[model samples]
Target: MKTARIIDILPQCYSLFLPPFFKNPIPIESAATCRNCAMLEKPDSHVHAPKFFSAKTKCCTHHPDIPNYLVGALMNSDDPEHETGRQRMLNRIAGKTSISPLGVFRPKKFTLLSRNSNLEYFGRSEFLRCPFHDDEGFCTVMPYWDAVCSTWFCKHDAGEEGWRFWRTLRTYLENLQKILSRYVLLKMDFKPSISGLSIDVSAPLTLQELDDLPPPEPIYRKSWGAWAGNETEFYKQAYTLIRQLSQDEFARIEGIEQKLLLRELEQAYGLLTTTPLPERLKKNPELNIEKISESSYLLSGYSPFDPLKISKRLYDCLDFFDGSLTNQQVIRLCHDQHEVGLPEEILKKLHRFRILIAVGETK
Candidate 1:
């Protein structure tokens, strides 16, 4: 069974908040097979995926906010293979482009463009491509990837349920990243100015502002406070501070909203991992069926992105589950009348994916 521990869910810098008991792996969605490129067009691809992404930039377009501790983790990695990524980090720091005491960020112009433009540019635009993405289409800083990079997936095995779990987890982790990075700065006695580098994004950008220039030196220096020139060392120190935090210390630092989010995340995770079949089943009234071939139909509606392919013979048997009979009775009826045996596992998947619904449940 494919699984990921709680520790595996986020970058190592955030591991101080996770309990030791959660190190045990439990079942979760399968990792995205990046090499195979699920979003790309393929002759044998079963899912009706759009050929929107090029192999060179398969959803590696967005700039992620690498928190200070994670930046330190990337720099301090002992793995010889991480040398290239580490050097890239040094280059970004030395360039004084997007580097801030909080960590690396997207330039204001790119951030403005992303806010204003349609999402059509997300996976196709080179302007928004991540610097950590190498020429070979591999992530250079995989081990110390930020929360956003860690939680994103193009597809989910548990369909909408899986998506919900990941979405909640992403929000929780993002919030934690912000809170904890600030906490690290405070712990280091560096009082980062909150209003030092404000951008007025309410108005449309002028052509000059769209030049994607780095922040002015004075403002950047003020934002970094005492850690302006010593960013690398400060980040390393931030990593050490966060690494030493006990679970109780983390809990004390986290707010009520974070606690609520963590609870929601736990509930979502439970729903994703557990598949409970109802006693009676019925075909979802809202399903959209497309005739792919004479013998096959694509069933969608639970999630538009993850469609299930069903045989025409099985499609015809959907009416047998009209909430009038038990699941076993419907299974028997299908087999006796149409010579189609409905396996328990397939039924569970169909129900889990919402192709089949519980008799009285509203989707």
Candidate 2:
């Protein structure tokens, strides 16, 4: 039997050496692996950065699985020289061996209480050191941690900016993982869990064998009240953190996020406006429009997540259309008054549901 040797003392000394930006020091009693000194530190200007190793950091000891999306991203990194790093991550996930060259502190195998009520167990091999952690107790990769790893911060619920910033990005990271999960599920025939793939850990299963297993049944979704509720909220925190950090790396993330939002909005607009006016024009008979609040109206038609706020605009474009005007005419009317493309966004949204349809098709 193995024991979890969580290093408590080193973190106190480690916290002292961290840069000034890390204002919140996790209390020793509460800090987990994510808040451990190794996860918190970055390489200093004076000290040589240590090489990557498999030694167990304080986090691996307690957690169940390292997210596959994080593993996949690292493997598929733009850095072509990351082949060795990729193989190491694969080996760690596969439970191939216990001993590593770095003398990583290995932790006892632990079970995760999965949302699906399945006994999801990580292989005994994984609770060793994180591949990104170096000998000097610093994380080599900081910004790109997947949803679970990013929120490993012990002070997340403490209402601090740094912790909240990571929470804001969690959904975005999870969405990326969902895309990868779809690809793997279709191609590899493996089932996905809320945390990761559901796999048996009694014996190490080869990638090929794991692929042969049947899919797991879906489970109920867990919800939370987060500061960043959607894309709009996500960008709010992203900008706030960028200003606070003043780090150039965060600027790149912000740029990418901006492009993604623009692309999604553009896609939504194009999808609605491209249809011919005479082909399908009618309010969706099935659309259940419910006035949720004085300011917000919930229309049951299309929601990428939930019922979209149709009344956020000054004028409800959907209410204006009565199948008498063409899509182009309605767009012209709204744009002529607003003089900005903002009205066009509203028009596109109205066209999204059968609120202002293309005419020939009956809803």
Candidate 3:
């Protein structure tokens, strides 16, 4: 037999001993923003937190909810930690907890899933405030928020890092759902393939269906204590597994982040001419633009896109906008006054970075 080289042996062993993937390099921002937002001053204004909705910041357009399996997990009280989570969730459901009136859960209006039912119970209410929101503008049960609420992000807040983080989290949640659902079915001696986890509570499977086609005695214990133990163990394993899964997924996608961000920049560049330039566009009064170099300029309070590089023509074009001129007018003036073919591409980038805003209609 021919002697094998080390290079040939390395590939096979790499898969066998792959390290547990940990640490999300992406920094996720979790602070609520409704209290200090300028938009909240408008009577019709709605809070935007990208995706996650809690007591402090709420997305009125898309009211989010807890998933069934996670609810089941919360019902467990096997350990002190689990019991605390369970009681907090119950308090929210009962409207006993102090919560804000920003999302969709209202005190006295929120209803819980029947304890005797299978994994079909969920909350529903007519109000825009979440039930767990307190009078002080905070979520009473933020620590135990549902998976969706925990992972949502606003596009502005997320940028490329946030997007990648959410994608990985979404994958983790899907896998977790499968694992927990199967665990529930297996405890009752049912085949895992026969049941599917419902994302919608309005159309949940009846307790009879959860018992399977023949309707047998419940395989999973129904008592709060018994359910608590099962769910607590499941949550522990789910969290550990998701961390590894998210890491693995991130490793695979890490190489493409820069490329994707560049593509987004490119697309934004293309929209410059088509989208009407904000008629009232002007430099943020609080921010002063300073020249860093012949080609680079810096603006205070600007993030993600700051200290931008600019050509003399582009700088002149920005000066022309002045809240009095439209983008087209600026382009025309640059050519007439300076004989420069000012590129609209640079303006588009500035607009996207909040360097420009439509404060009012231009005269």
Candidate 4:
């Protein structure tokens, strides 16, 4: 009922009603309003452009009227009628003074969620903003945003050091952001096959064993990618307590991730930005990050995170070598998976591509 900000999660090429790879021929207006919904102004933007009205917009497809989502994602719990039942931010936040030693050894409880609970939340599958945020000013969960939320604040608020309890929050967030930034922006190639259409990759995880990776305490887990399918893959889907990336942080993280990927392989150990990249690259047999960087900009580059250049180098390397390895194969080899075996999730990807030439899968 409150005016909340929301974005439309429209599929890029494929639509159930439209043809595959069919783009929106109509241009979006200055307000970023879809042309499909140009006529209708009231609550129902549908009566105007009925043709492209998608269920996702929660109204007409052509005339999309998405409510702006100002807050972060959340999961609702039943009202806290009992004294003990309550919801806390579920992340392993690094600061605070609320809990004592005895509290550490205890379990926290939350109640069942209903359509209308005290808490307003989104789907648990992927990360999103909490629905309880009042569009006008403050967040409903401010007092109880929990440890992680309490700790993180950005350079935007230059003078205000968040919480004062943890000055190191920014550093930790930066490190985690570096790792998250890489995978979070990785665009997946979404090919539509009828087989996986109705399958639910985001199942409500239930566990019989309490200790065996039980469901994340509702508000605790970072969520992202509630927007699925083809186009959404190209965007940042990873949900975290603090979502925005400072310009410097984004650049720094990219560089670090590139270094990390290159360093994981034994061949790229001596790579230095100063060393002649070509000379250094020629010596290393595989996954030479130095070579990739040198060749791309003639050894005149500085950022550790260059996916385009790296992917190009990977392709070029794959082309030159007469060996039987594919691009994905080189990636797997770079990961040092032989010692620890391929992870099940990665194994699924390999199987999908039919690139599992190496034997051995865990049962």
Best by TM-score: 1
Give, for candidate 3, the lowest lDDT window spanning 10 residues: 98-107
Name the better of 3 and 4 by TM-score: 3
TM-score of each: 0.87, 0.28, 0.37, 0.18
Residue 293 shift from truth in candidate 3, angstroms: 32
Order of candidates by TM-score, top first? Answer: 1, 3, 2, 4
Query: lDDT of model 4 at residue 278?
Result: 15
Q: Candidate 2: minimum summed lDDT over ten consecutive residues — where?
A: 219-228
The lDDT-based order of candidates, best leading, equals 1, 3, 2, 4
The predicted structure with the larger lDDT, 1 or 3, is 1
What TM-score would candidate 2 get against the native?
0.28
Misplaced by over 4 Å in model 4 are: 1-28, 31-249, 255-363
Better of 3 and 4 by lDDT: 3
Q: Taking the tens digit of each residue's C-alpha lDDT, what string does model 2 give over 1-363?
A: 122112122112112222232342333323233433432335541122222222344343233233332344454465644555555555553442221111111222322222223321211134334565544544543333344554444322122222333444344445533443333333333333322232345555444334432123122111111311231222223323222333343333334553464355344323322433352244555555666566656554432112334553433545435567665665565567644343444544455443445555454
lDDT of each: 0.77, 0.37, 0.40, 0.25
The Cα RMSD of model 2 versus the native structure comes to 21.4
Runs of candidate 3 with Cα error greater than 4 angstroms are 1-24, 27-39, 42-57, 60-88, 91-128, 155-176, 180-196, 199-363
Of candidate 1, the 10-residue stretch with the lowest lDDT total is 191-200
Q: Cα deviation in Å at residue 213, candidate 3?
A: 24
Candidate 1 wrongly placed segments (more than 4 Å):
46-49, 115-118, 195-209, 285-288, 320-326, 359-363
- TM-score (C-alpha) between model 4 and the true structure: 0.18
Q: Provide the clashing-pair count of each candidate structure.
A: 0, 14, 17, 29
